[model samples]
Target: KLLSVGALTLDTILRVETLPVHQGKFIASDGLQIASGMATSAACAAHRLGAEVSLWASAGDDAVADQL
Candidate 1:
C-alpha cells in the first residue's frame, strides 16, 4: 500500500509570453494547466505497479480538493 499527502501545485503555463517590464503588459500565446500532486503521482505509480494507494492532503477552498 502507498500513501500520499500534500496539495498539488497547480501550474499556469504561458507560451510566447514575456515578463512585464516598466509596467508593460505581455500576453500569453497559449496556456495549459494541470492538476498534479506529489501524492497523486506516487499513488498513480503505485497503482500501475499493482499496489493499493491512499492520499491525505490539505486542500484549498477551490475544487482542487475534490478533484484530487
Candidate 2:
C-alpha cells in the first residue's frame, strides 16, 4: 500500500489554437478536468500499477471541494 499526502486539486486543461495575448477575451477549443496534485498524481500512478494507494488531502466546504 502507498500513502500520499499533499494538495489535491482539479486540473483544468484547455486546448486552444492560439494563446490569448491581449487577454481581453479568449476561448478554448476544448477543456477537461482531472484530479491532480503532486501527491495525488503519484498516488494515482501507483494505483494504476496495481498498488493500493491512499491520498490525504484537504478541501474547502464548497462546490469545488465537493467535486474533489
Per-model C-alpha lDDT, please? 0.71, 0.89
Q: In candidate 1, which residue ranges exceed 4 Å CA deviation?
A: 17-24, 48-50, 63-68
RMSD of 2: 1.4
Candidate 2 Cα misplacement greater than 4 A, ranges? 21-24
lDDT value for model 1: 0.71
Clashes of 2: 0
> Model 2: per-residue lDDT, tens digit, 5-68?
9988989999988877775766788999998999999999999999999899997789888999
Q: Point out the worst 10-residue segment of candidate 2 by lDDT.
A: 19-28
- Count clashing residue pairs in model 1: 0
